[model samples]
Structure formats: structure tokens, C-alpha cells
Target: MTDHATTFRRLHQEGLLLLANAWDAGSARLIESVGAKAIATTSAGLAWSNGYADGDTLPVERLYAAVESIARAIRVPLTVDAESGYSDDPAAVGATIARLGALGAVGINLEDGDGTPEALCAKLDAIKRACAQAGVDLFVNVRTDIYLRGLAPEGERVGATLARARLYRDAGADGLFVPGITQRTDIADVVAGTSLPVNVLAYPGLPAAAELAQLGVRRLSAGSGLSQTLFARAAELARGFFRDGDSAPLSAGAMPYPEINALFAQR
Candidate 1:
């Protein structure tokens, strides 16, 4: 646990946190196979797996179960996207964080300032109290979605961005995740606003990895992009099969028969 704490805290260096969001144990292990520093659970990813909405539709129990399965599959530090902390209550958020700790979640990303900024604040307050009551050193990476889903009309993404960043920081957030922060100036402003390391989502036609590092972005999450891309690729392949009306390339690059047997080779 201490090791994960140090690692989660160390992303502030020039080093980048290549956090690949996973949906299940298979995906989690596959990411670990290719070498990812840590794993972040995407609510959308998990929701799709369970056939639900991307928001807080998934029951708390099911979410924790997914985290437990992923934790068992990977060796790296696991960060969970505890969407809205399951409820608006602070005690619930803290209880959820404690449950995550029991299942091996070393870090958590709690978002506030979505619409009711006061509610977000209340939830973060609960998370802090719960983490303390539970005696778990869960690094709460408080995410503020104002810039991403709630842009302003006066072209003040920067203003809204800075305001919410400070709000979460003061609410006991260990780090800040500012989604939709594409502009260099906006990201720089967020970094300047708070001492917490800023997390940015990977977007198309945006700055490169080097650029984000230059802007002081320590943690970079793929968010739902990876899952969306995989879904698009699968759709394309499925359409290809429908057009071909016969055998396709699905089995061409698939694991060999021996590899299939290897799933149970060493238990």
C-alpha cells in the first residue's frame, strides 16, 4: 500500500503516468502484459461491460466487484473511478473508498463541481472523513469536469477551470483531474492554481505527450477513449464479417490453440 502511495504521488516528476483504463480482469491483465505503470478503472468501461449507463448506474456492489477482479489480475497500483462517490453523501463516499481499499484499490478519483458544485464539495468532504475513519491511505484524485462537460458561454473555460480546480483542492483532493483542458494556457493555469498534480485526458488533435509534460501534466489518463476506440474497431470488424458473409480475419491474429489451452495451464 505504501509502495502504491509513493508511486501515485511520484507522477508529478517529469515522468508520465501511462494510465490505461480497463473494464475487466482480462483487459487489466492485457494492459499489464504490455507494461503500464498503473491501471485506472473507467466507469464507462465498466458500465458497458455490465450493460448500463456510463454514469452512476452501476450499483456500488458491482463496481467494487469489478475493481476486485481487476486488482486480482494486475500487479500495478490500481486507481478506481468512483463515479460521484456512488452517492452525494460524504459518508457513503468514504465508505466506498474504504471498501475499495479492502479490494486493493490504492488510489481513487472523485469528481465534483459537475453541476451542483456544493454537492461535489460535500462528497469530497465525506471522502476525506471516510478515508480517515477507515484508516486507508487512498490517494483521492479529485476530478472536476467543468471544463469538459460544462464549458461557459463567455469563452471562460479558463475561468471555470481555475475556479473548480481550486474548489477541489481545498476540499482535500490529493490531485486535480481537469478533463477537456486542451489549451496550453488553460492547463498551465490549472497547474498554477493548485499544487496538486493535474491530470488531463487524451484527446484527438490535441497536444502531444511532450507538450503535456511541458505544461506540467504529470498524470495522463486515456479515459474512455481507449474503450471507445476498441468498440469502433470491433464494429468495423463485425461489419466486415457481415459483408464477407463467411470466414473473416478474427482468428488470423488470435492466440494459438496452445495459448488457448494455456489459460488453464498454470493455476
Candidate 2:
């Protein structure tokens, strides 16, 4: 395995890998400056930044450009959120992952939204093959939306997730990301059900980091929460500026231009 891949995989076995998702190169470099272990891209955040909605609506080339930009802007390992692989065909998804690997992405988030387990398994198999061909030890974190999309009842959610986790692991997934799961009991059950590293999305009701580690979660991602919060704050700032014609609100908590420019100068 490459050093980047090794570092990323080892993180899952050690402490909690906290990922603050970035939507653009500037956001990525800023996050990396804060001592993040790795950089993750949120599909929704990227899409919104590019004036496109999520759900695979962003052009494939645009996604590639964004990933490449972020990869070039940071020193740490990058993990692209390639939602649903951006294609239904297994080979196509594999090719996309291989290209991402070539662009310095050591990991990817592939989801099984409404697809069948078998189809996701097939896609995973193809991804493994592509990674092998490229000699990239890409960490594929398979995401199941049983709870996020309301695919199963509250009582059946854990069971449904476990079944998909087994299939995905068999298909060579390195980790299992169960988003929208915050309860301690449910998190513990999913962690115990799988040997693969468990990744959870950070939400309002989610337990603290210490508590999550105790429950055996290896990674916690902010998903699109950071971007959503940022834009919302930006909107408020704009509203205040327009109403009162004051620069005070816009200047608060803003990074100095010199420091912001230094991030790119060091590159």
C-alpha cells in the first residue's frame, strides 16, 4: 500500500478520525491548517458551490476538476465523496474511481442509496479491480442509507444496515459509513455487527467524540453540515450588510488576507 493509503487505513484502527468536509480548495487548505488528519469532500457542498444541486446532478468533469484542485491544494490524504459513483454501471464507476486515485485521492465514499445490495456489491468488486489496476490502495467506505433515506423502519434499520455491511465487506469495502445514526445503542450494535471500521456522520443528536470512541466508531464526518452552516452565516451577514450598510458584521471572525494568501503562497 502507498504511504497515503496506509496512513488513512491505519487511522481507522487507532483513534477517531475526525473529518471536516471541504467544498473547495480554499476551504480544504483552511481545514488542513487546523490539523485535520485528512481532507474529505462533501458532494452536496461541492455541488452547491458549483451552482448545481446534489443527487449526481453535477457534471462528471466538474467534479474531477474540484477534486484535482483540492488534491493539489493540500498535503494530507484526500477522500472524494463520489456519490453513487455517478453512474449505474459497475465498470464506469470503477473507471471513475481509478481516475480519482490517479488524481491523489486515497479514498472514496460510495453509497447504496436505493440500489439493491447485489448491485452495490458488483460496483464494489469493480472498484477493487480498478484500484488494483492503478496500484492504488483506495479505501472504499461503503455507505448504506437505511436510516438516512428512511429505507427501513426504526426497528429494522440496524438489521438492514448489518446485512448490507456484510455484502459490502465481502466485496472489498474498507469501512462502513452509516449516516443519520446518532443513538448510542444503534451505533454500538452496528459497530459490533461488522469487523470493518465504522464511520458515522456528525449530527445534532450525535454523542460526543469521547462517547463515540467508546462505542467503537473509527471515524466521524461532518458531511455537508460545515458548508450548510457557512452559507447560512454568509446569508445572514449579507442581510445585515444590506440592511444597515455596515462592514462590522462582515469583518468579524474573518481571516486576514495575508494569512489567507499565505496558504496558497506556501504551495
Candidate 3:
């Protein structure tokens, strides 16, 4: 049996694991071309990238299909963003993650969000037990959204995050993810507080890869930021082509036709 979780954990330990979130095969191949070590699915990016709303609007079948496409496209370990597991029941969600393992997935981003902390921890525990029972080394990327939800008042973001992180870690989470954190001091503080490797969202000019590496950041997820940037650029290019008729800046004699042709291949 392939040790998918084992393979993924090594990536976290060795260096900065830049997980390029790909909603389809083309993005996976493109990230592979640029030498990304692993590929991850973005729940928001996948839905929005494919013209659906965020959250469970995409459905489990469609999201699972996206993961299959990406897993087939790249050899690197794949981590899926199974948003809230799309269900309230933890056992059912754990079943979903285990099913993903059957499809060659090594890791998953599970969030303890959308409810109270105690409720979220129970869900996390359920998934961990399921992973262990399956004999799969599942790298559970636990996302703590205290800051993301604007609940970290009194500059207590670090303390709040630590509380969540400690709970998840003790509950058997593989990593702690805290997005929307903007301060370097807080970044260091959070990293200091948790024995688990910290994962932060990418921000402009906040910290370089080296700076984050020094702070003991094991993983750096682009979250939905990459998809947002891509769409923004695409919107700009669309306007140019609409008015200029094939004289757009994006059509600057690049994007090989063969690579584009390869996107729609049957699986």
C-alpha cells in the first residue's frame, strides 16, 4: 500500500511546501510544470473557478471528481480541501476522507469552523480515528478560523488560535492552519505556542519564504488567493479582447496550443 500520508508529511518537514490548489487537471499540470512539490484542491477556488458558489454548492460528487482529475494529472501527493466535509455528521465526513484515500489522496484540509469549538473538535476526532483505522497516514490539515471570522478581538488572535490549535493537535490533527493573520509578531507568536507545524496564508510583502521558514512554518497555503488573482487577470484580459478583437495582451504569443489541448482529456 502507498504511504500517501507519510509522503506528504516529509514534504512539510523538508522545506516550504508550496501547495498549488488546482481545481482541474490543467492547473495541476501547470503547477507540475513550474515544479510544485504537491497539489491541493481549493474548495472556494474549485467552486468559483468552475462557476459555482463557495461552500457545499459544488456537491461532494463534483468535488470528488475534481480530486480524481487532479490526482491523475500529477504524481505528487494530493491534499483535498473537503469543506466541512459537506455534512454535520463526523462519521460520514470521515467516510468521505477515507474514500478519498482510495482515490490516491494523501492529505486533507479539515476545518473546525462554522460552529462552536467543542463541536468542531468532535468532528476532528472522528476523522482522525477513521484515518487510523484505515491504516492510512492521513495528514489532516486542521484550519482554525478564529481570525478569519473576526472573533479574535483584543489582539488575542494568537491566544485564541493557540487554544484551537492545541485542541486539534491533542485530538490528533497533523497541522494547524490559521488564515488572515497579517502581523509577523503574531506569526512568530503562534508558531511558538504550538508544537504542531503552523500553516499561514500568503500575503504581499508580509514575509518572504525564508522569513516564514525561520519562524517554523511547515506549510503555506494560497487558499483562495491564487484563484482570485487568476480571475482578476482573466477579467482584465477579457475586456481587452472584447474591445480589441484578438489583439489582447494575454494573447501575447504564448500558452502553447498543445498544452491547452491536453486539458480536456478523458480519464
Candidate 4:
């Protein structure tokens, strides 16, 4: 666990760490097989895969089970997205993170969503304490939704994000994630404003990987984009099968069965 935790932390020190986020054990293993340095879960994808909606709606126990399964499936470091930590109480959130650590997650993405910075800080503090007591090491990536949720007025979003970044950094964050800021100037400003590794989500207007690295961005995540696309594709295939009973479209562009089976067969 210590080794995995250290490796996960070191991946953020330089360059842009591209995370093709996964939602389940199969997705995680496939990602690792494709040379991903680390695996980060997409909360929305994971929730939807388990028949639940995104946000803080999934049961904590289900979250734990999912993390454990992914951890066991992949050899690389695993980071789970605990959306709002699944509770408002800092202690409960902290305990939830600690349990994830015990299940082999080396890092976590904890978002502030519509909550206050002070609330996130309290949760970070509690997480630090809980992990220490439980002898677990975790990289707490603090996510501020200032840009994602339009928490600030135009032109002042950068300042608001930096302010929250400072608070989260002081409260023991290892990285700062600003999910919805896409402009080159805004991205550069946020990176320059904070010392923590800056993570940006994959969006339509976001810069390419090389440009992001040049701007000092440390990590880029796919979020739920891949899953959403897969959902759409599945729906299309199902519709075709139901309408014309054509089996050809279902196998088109599909991964070979043996190749996918080999992934799980290794374990």
C-alpha cells in the first residue's frame, strides 16, 4: 500500500498525468493494460454501472465493494472518487475514506460540489486524522466546483478557485482539481495560482495534452465521458437489435471476447 501510495503521488510531480477514468474492475484492468500509470474511478460512471444515479446517492457499502473489486483487478495504484464523501459529517466522511484506504485505494478525489470551502476543509482535517489513526496513506485531491458549478461570477472564477485551493491545501490536500475551467488563460491562471498539482477535467474546449502540460497542468481526467459514450453506443445497439433483430451491429467494433476474458482469467 505504501509503495502504491508513493507511486500515485509521484505521478503528479511533473508532466500531465492522463487519466482515462474507469468505473469497474473490468474497465480498470483494461485501462491498466493500456499503460495507464494509475487508475482513477469516475463516480458517476461507477454509480450508473451499479444501477444508481450520480452524485452522493450511492450507498457507502456499495462504494466500498466497488473499490475493493477494482483494487483487486488492477496492479497499478487506484484512486476512487468519493463524491462529497457520501455524508455531511466530517467524521463519517473520514471513516469512509479510511475504509477505502484499507481496501487498497491509494488516493481519492473528494469534491466540494455545492458545499462551502470551510466544510471541505473540515472534512480534509478529519480525513487526515482518520487515516493517521488507521495507518493508511491517502492522496486527498481536493476538488473545488467553483468553475463546474458556476459558483463565481465571470472574470472572478480564477480568484475564487485559488482561494479555495489555498484553504484545501492548508487543510492537507495533495492536489487541486478544477473540473470545469476550460479557457487557456483560466487554466494557466489557476495553475500559476497554486503550488498543488492542478487537475482539469476533459471538456469540449479544453486544451490538448501537450498544451496543458505547457501551461503547467499536472493531471487530466476523462471523468464520465467514456462511460456516457459507451452508454449511448449500447442503447443504439440495443435499439437496432430490437427493431430488426440484426446481430451484426452488436459485434461491430466490439473487443474480442477472448481478449477480455484473458484479463479476468489472470486472477
Candidate 5:
């Protein structure tokens, strides 16, 4: 666990760490097999996979079970997208994160969505204390929804994000995740303003990986994009099967049964 924690933290020191977020054990193992340096969970994907909606609606116990399954399935470091820590009380949130860390998660993405920066700071402080008490080393990647939620005007977005970043960093954040930020100048400004590694979500207008690296971006996340695509494809396949009972489309581009079975079999 210490080796994984150290490696997960070192991945952000230089270059762009591309995180193809996974939702389940199967997805996580497949991602690791493809050479992913680390596995980060997508809260949206995980919720949807478990028959729940995205946001803070999913139960924390369910999240713990999911994290445990993913951790057992993959050898690389695991990071969870614990949306708002699933509670308003800082202590409860901190305890939840500590449990995840104990379940083999080396990092977590905690966001401030439609919430005050001070609230997130309190949570971060509580998390730090809780992790210390539990002898857990967790990389708390603080996420600000200024850009994602349109919390600021076009010109002031960068400044607002940086302001939140500073608060989070002071409160013991290891990285800063700014979703929905796409412009090069805005990305660079946020990166330069804070000492924490800057993480950006994959958006339509986001720059290429090489360009993002040159602009000092440290991490790029696919968020729920891959899961959304898979959901759409599943819907299409179901519709086609229900309409014509054709089995061919279902197997199109599908991984062979043996290959998929091999993943769980090895475990």
C-alpha cells in the first residue's frame, strides 16, 4: 500500500497523467491491462452501474463495496471519485475517506460542487486528521466546480478557480481538479497560480495531451465520457434486439468471452 501510495503521488510530479476512469472491477482490471499507471473511479459511472443516479445520492456503504471490489481486481493504485464525500458533515466525510483508504484506495477526488470553499476546506482538514489517525496516506485531489457549474463569469472563471485552489491547497490538498476548463490560457493561468498539480477534465474544446503538458497541466481525466458512450451503445443494442431479434449487432466489437473471463479467472 505504501508503494502504491508513493507511486500514485509521483505520477503527478511531471508530465500529463491520463486517467481513464473506471466504474467496476472488470472495467478497472481491463484498464490496468491496457497499461494505465493508475485507476480512478468515475462517480457517475459507478452510481449508474449500481442502479443509482449520479451526484451525492449513492449510499456510502455501496461505494465502499465497489471500491473494495475494484481494489482487489487491479494491482495498480486506485483512486475514488467520492462526490462531496457523500455527506455534509466534515467528520462523516472524513471517516468515509478513511474507510476507502483502508480498502486500498491510495487517492480520492473530493469536489466542491454548489458548495462554499470554506466547507470544502473543513472537509479536507477533517480528512487529513482522519487519515493520519488511521495511518493512511491519501492523495486528496480537491475539485472545484467553478468552471463545471459556471460559478463565475467568463473572464473571472480563472481567478475564481485559482482562489478556490489556494484555499484547498492550504487545507491539505495534494492536487487540484478543474473540470470543464478548456481554454489554453485559462488552463495555464490556473496551473501557474497554484502549487498543486492541476487536473482538467476531457471536454470538447480541450487541448491535445501534448499541448496540455506544455501548458503545465499535470493530469487529464475522462470523467464519465467512456461510461456514457457505453450506456448509449447498450441502449442502441437493446433497441435493435427488441425490434428484430438480431443477435449479430450484440456481438459487434464485443470482447471475446474467453478474454473477459480470463480477467476474473486470474483473480
Candidate 6:
């Protein structure tokens, strides 16, 4: 925790902390080889990869297994997306997060979803206490879905998010993640309105990283886009192979087996 937490926190304050979210150990290692500063797991990606639908339905044990595998394979600080803390009980959620800390995770994304701000703050407080008890400085990234869930009217979205951001921060959050925000003005408003580091999702056609940084974004996440794209390609290849018996798509833009296999080898 000492080695990773300090670095992960420093990254958010310095420059853009771009995370190529991984669903498995293989993806974590691959992203690390390409020089990702940290590893973040996409709950949606993890669910899809594990044959479950994206939602708050992922079992904590399965999530732990995925994180454990990735933790063992990568040296970079890892942040797991623990959607809604996976439980309504704040203590249960905190215990689960503490388990992640033991597995070498430096941070977690605990979303509020459509839940109340008070409830999410309770979870944040509990998680902070659990981390302290465990002697781990886990970066609790509180994700507010006011925009994503349409919890407020268009005119009131920014204010709603800001209000929740302050509550989460007061409850012990280290960062704020607002996924549905794309507009530069709205982004700047959120940044100026909050003391926590702001993280935004990389939606299609959104501004580039340079533009986002100028808007005061401290982190950018690819969410489940990478997994969706990768799996989409696999489905396309399978469809083509069965329909036309053409294997050409198999070799197109695919990394060589040996190169990929080398990623797991001892360095």
C-alpha cells in the first residue's frame, strides 16, 4: 500500500492519470507493457468477461478473484471499480474494500448510482475507517451518477453533482468521478466546484486528453469501451469464419501469440 498509494495519489495531482481499464490479468499485463501508469478494472468489463451482465450483480468473491489475478501480474497501482460497494450495508462494503487493499489494490471507484447522497457518504465513511484499521491508504474514489442517471434536470445537473462531490469528499473520498460529463464548460464547472481530483469517462467524440487537461481533469478512464470493442471484434471474426470460412480476419491487427505470452513471463 505504501509503495502504490503514494504514487497513485501523486499521479492525480501532477498530470492526467489515464487508465486503460482492464477486466482480467492478461489485459492488465498488456496495458502495463504499453506503459500505463496505473491499472483500473471496469466492473462492466469484468462482468462481461466473466459471463455476467454489467450491473451491480457482480459477486464480491468473483471480483476479488479477478483483482487478485491482476494484482499478482502487475506492479502498477490497481484501482477496482466496486460498483455501489456491492452491498447496501456500509460495514459490509467497507470490509470488502479492505479485502481489496489486502490484495494490493491502491484504490477503488465506489459509485452512488441512483442511491441517495447520504447513503453513499455513509459507505465512504465506513470504507475510510476500514482502510485506516487495515493500515492501508486506499484512495476512495467516489463516483457520482447524478448526470449519468439523470437524477437532476439538465439545468441543475452540475449543481447536483457538485453538492454530492462535497459530501463524498467530506466523508473521506480522495477523488471524484463524473462519467456522463463531456462538455468542457460543464467539466470546468465541476473542477472549480470541488476540491477533489476530477475524473471523466472517455465517451465517443469527447474532447481529447489535452483538451480535458486544460479543463482541469485530473484523470480519464476508458470505462468498458476497450472490452466492448475487443469482444465486438471477436464476435465479428467468429461470424465471418462461420459464414464464409474466411480466416483472414483472425490475423488482422492481432498481436502475435509469443509477444502476448511474454507479458506473463518473469521480467
Q: For residues 158-185, write the lDDT of model 4, one tens digit per residue.
A: 9999999999999999999999999999
Q: Candidate 1 vs candidate 2: which has greater TM-score?
A: 2
lDDT at position 71, candidate 5: 95
For all the candidates, what are their Cα RMSDs to the real structure? Answer: 2.2, 1.1, 2.3, 0.7, 0.7, 1.0
- In order, candidate lDDTs are 0.79, 0.93, 0.79, 0.95, 0.95, 0.91
Candidate 3: how many backbone clashes?
A: 0
**Which residue pairs in candidate 2 have backbone atoms (N, alpha carbon, C) closer than 3 angstroms, thus clashing?**
none
Tens digit of per-residue lDDT, candidate 1, span 84-127? 88776677777888889878898888776455667777777877
Question: Model 3 over residues 196-263: C-alpha lDDT tens digits?
Answer: 88888876655887888888888888777778888898898898789887764876766878776665
lDDT of 6: 0.91
Any runs in candidate 1 off by more than 4 Å, and if so which?
255-267
Q: Write the per-residue lDDT of candidate 2 for residues 1-267, one digit (tens) a residue.
A: 278888988888997999999999999999999999999999999999999999989888998999889988999999999999999999999999999998889999999999898999999999999888988789999999998998999999999999999999999999999999988999999999999999999887999999999999999999999999999999999999899999888888998999899999957
Once model 6 is optimally superposed onto the true structure by TM-score, how far is the C-alpha of residue 22 displaced, in angstroms? 0.5
- Give the poorly placed runs of model 3, Cα more than 4 Å off: 1-3, 248-250, 259-267
lDDT: which candidate is best? 5
Q: Which scores greater on TM-score, model 1 or model 4? A: 4
lDDT of 5 by residue, 20-123 (tens): 99999989999998899999999999999999999999999999999999999999999999999999999999999999999999999999999999999999
Q: lDDT at 39 for candidate 1? A: 86
Query: Candidate 4 or 5, higher lDDT?
Result: 5
TM-score of 4: 0.99
* TM-score comparison, 2 vs 3, better candidate: 2
User: After aligning candidate 6 to the native by TM-score, how far in Å is the CA of 119 from where it should be?
Assistant: 0.6
